[model samples]
Target: MATTSTQRFGIFAALALVMAATRVHLSLFHHDIWDASWGVFFLAGFWLRGTGRWAFPLLMAEAVLVDYVVITRMGISFWDHYCVSAGYWFLVAAYGALWIGGSWLAKHQRGIKLSTLGMAVAALLVSENACYVISNGSFYWLSAHVPAPKSFAAWFENLGDWYLPFLETTAVYVGLGGVLHVLAVQLARLSQHSGQTQH
Candidate 1:
């Protein structure tokens, strides 16, 4: 149990680092890397499932801090930024959707199997879509950036425009995370087996 706790802490730290590193500059490796905030939240839920009471809020704070720094560095007031608005608060719910999806996947996972992979994919899709709806819908309907007299047709079209890019970017990170998770599990099993043999 101690080992599991340590491992979970390690994963949480790594995800937090990834989020800060990718988000702080808003561009990484000279614009080659997209933000990993979405992926980090999902992976956090999976790896740090039981720690959400503190872990989730900590990550959320880190996200806000990173944004504050990035926006300020650009000579823009954080509150005056185009993305900052009443709608912005809805991100809590948007990200919560991702965290819940990941937790659900962790609960349902029955080992590193085909079914597990399917579950992960399903969870990602459902969570990402829900997140998109909440975040995007809130922005479109509640933010001052969007002109008044909004229509469902325009909003739906807007959703279609950006949905794929967000999904694809998040998929890239989560897919990589999935591979690393499988490798870590396999390595742990091998180490355990080796220990048993020595005993």
Candidate 2:
């Protein structure tokens, strides 16, 4: 149990580090990397499911902090930033959808099999779409950044324009994460088998 707790903490720390490193790249001196914020949240949901009470809130706060720092660094007031609006709060829901999707996947996962892969892809598709909808919809409808006279057609068009890019970016990170997950699982199994053989 102690070892498990330590391992969980390590995973949490790693996720937090990834979030900081990727989410704040624009604010940092370099601007070469794409933001992995969405992937981090999904992976966190999968890896840190049991710790959501503290971990989820902590990650959310970290996201807000990153945004605040980035905006302030650009000479924009935190509250006055075009991204910061009532719609901004809806991000909590958007991210929650991702976290929940990850948690659901974790619950249903049954090891390294084609079925598991299918489930993972399904979960990612559902969660990512739901998240995109919440975040994009809120921003389009509620944020002042968009000019008035919002309409269903315009919103649908906007979704079509951005959805593919967001999905692709998230899929790239999540795919890497899936590879790492498979390696870890395989290594653990090999270690266990070796230990049994020695016994």
Candidate 3:
């Protein structure tokens, strides 16, 4: 649960580069736009350090930057821009908790089972659906506007409309997240071994 400044900076810098590259190369970056997000980076930090506290600030930065870029540059309402961003924070939380990597997923002696992964994927899809339904309108939910769903009695009636995009985006992001987690661990292990050799 502790680390040196060097390790932290190395991980942060590596993740930032990966995120920027993924955003720019979505069409050919091993995934599509829907799956784009420094999701891999987020989860990597989470598992490597056993907490994604670093990712929170990054995600927040992403949200704020996106809101401004979209609002000021493209004439989008600033508030509306963040409404849809809400779901991404939820996603960060989800990935941050992925303490495993499949049959091989494990953290601090705790391995992740297939059951956990399934539940996580389902939970994420539902969370994103709710996010779109609330932020936009179960339709556009474009900006940050919390679409007042007249009554809780029928709040979920428009869920299906938001399912496709959410699933597509999260699946690819989460899959990449798994990769990031492994990469971070491997990098850390490699660093340790290299140090041992020098010693």
Candidate 4:
């Protein structure tokens, strides 16, 4: 759909604000829709499209700042609580994969086709699985909290246990987003046709 510069910026800004709120919720509540963190990334990428290049960094910084405040004010060690380390930086790559997948989808497809929808779902699965492996693998290998010497199968099993929640969250957000996008397009078309009839 064609959009004005102001419209594009406003949409992106709104997404950023919502994501910021979601981060705050996750930080304070510490549960109940933590998957919004993951959902927002792909949503931002899908909606922001070209602007996603910048939105991702901003959203990531927001997440990091929220974590910093939570750790500092709440009097908890992030490393101890989350088992983070230098490996935590791997999150960049993980999230980048998600962003890339969504951006690719945006560029390749305009209206949703079944084939494109399948591709989008596949992309999310691939990106989420990659994120799980990179983020969790790093934690398993590089974090001080993981007892020395872990088995691959054990790690694989652990990865499986957590995978469904992440997948479900991403699917829900993306699926809802797709539906909204379709509705918006249909409305725009209807409005445009009405304007043409008035002439």
Candidate 5:
């Protein structure tokens, strides 16, 4: 059997694609608090590491395509309902921040230790908070949805409602990704050991 680079990254790539698709579906149909796209973005950088430069942009492009399809084909009316304006473009920065945080954390990758888990959680929180601020702040300020008088207090209040859900969702998904990565590595090691014994 032969393995190309894509094949080598097959598991992570498949996971990323599934997560991305789920995100799109959730956005269009569910619109729930448990969004997975942000976590998947972070996982992409964590898993891809050196490949993140290209991977992050590719994922962002996927997001944009999904949003377009949702609004145009699915009759979601995201543009009409949500105040995107130029602020929507800020998602590039918001999501990029997540990618950078994940890439940085990957440099310190370790087993499922308390220290590693804490570090990952800390990084995730920072990235998630930054993403929320950028995304929410942009929408509040630039979205035509907001009336003439933009109330900073009102935005903060809305943020308070959303912030916890954002953190919880990201934490849950990232934790799951970590568990999956660890299990996959252990399974691969066990398989290799069995092959050695067979010979």
Candidate 6:
């Protein structure tokens, strides 16, 4: 619990590298699909730390690199790249990270309780939807500049474009990602327990 300066720096650096490398695949493969990659990022940055400021920049950096690399590989100039593409997702992730890191971690660290865990889980789910809605807001701005699809539906179309993929992907991504986080924490606790037993 008492993470030293070196430990904190090491954690941050390792996370950055892991996030950067995985993000490459996420950008290249899913490109348009928001799942598979980002769900893990949200969980890590959110649940792993309580510092909102640190989480925001690092997570955003990881996300940006994915997009930047992919767009460059495709030989597409991002000079006209929609700012919203970058900005809002960062907003969504940052928001979720802060919500989990600040609120959940703060409460849970105080004590282990079922109600606390349930509240944390509920917050995480709501945060996902909030991020989706925020991204759609980004789309709303992008749509104004880009060609709005000509149809009776405008906002609904934008909502569908992002929300559907978000929900479908989060279903798989969040569940798996949650398990990974839980396992990792359990492993850490196990190691600590074993060390204490040996002592």
The lowest-lDDT stretch of 10 consecutive residues in candidate 5 is 1-10
Query: Any residue pairs clashing in model 1, and if so which?
Result: none
67 Cα displacement, candidate 3 (Å): 2.1
Model 3 lDDT tens row, 86-178? 443453444333322211232323324566566555544554444445433432333234455454444455456555665566567767665
As a whole number from 0 to 100, the lDDT of residue 184 in candidate 1 is: 81
Q: Model 5: per-residue lDDT, tens digit, 89-166?
A: 999988887887788788885756789878888888888889989988988888887787878898998899888888
User: What lDDT does the true structure give each of the candidates?
Assistant: 0.88, 0.87, 0.49, 0.74, 0.77, 0.57
lDDT of 2 by residue, 38-150 (tens): 88888888887777898899999999999999989889899898878888999899999888888888889887899989998999999999999999999999988899899
Please give the distance, in angstroms, between residue 9's alpha carbon in candidate 5 and its true position after superposition.
Answer: 4.5
For residues 1-199, write the lDDT of model 6, one tens digit per residue: 2246665565456556655666676656765444344454455554445555775566676666666777778677654455435444545554464346334544454434566566556655666677666655655654445475544377667677666666666556556655665677788899999999998
Query: lDDT tens string, model 1, 1-199?
Result: 1137778788888899998988865632454668899998888888788888988999999988888888887899989999999999898999999899888888889988999999999999999999999999999999888998999999999999999999998899999999998888889999999999999
Which digits, one per residue and each the tens of the lDDT, describe model 4 over residues 91-167? 88877777877777777774757888888887778877777788778877777777757889888887888778778
Q: What is the lDDT of residue 167 in candidate 4?
A: 82
Which of 1 and 5 is ahead in lDDT?
A: 1
Give me candidate 4's TM-score against the actual structure: 0.88
Error of 4 at 179 (Å): 2.0
Candidate closer to the true structure by TM-score (higher is better), 2 or 6: 2
Better of 1 and 4 by TM-score: 1
Q: In model 3, which residue pairs have backbone atoms overlapping below 3 Å?
A: 80-143, 80-144, 83-144, 100-105, 101-105, 136-141, 137-141
Cα shift from native, residue 71, model 6 (Å):
1.1
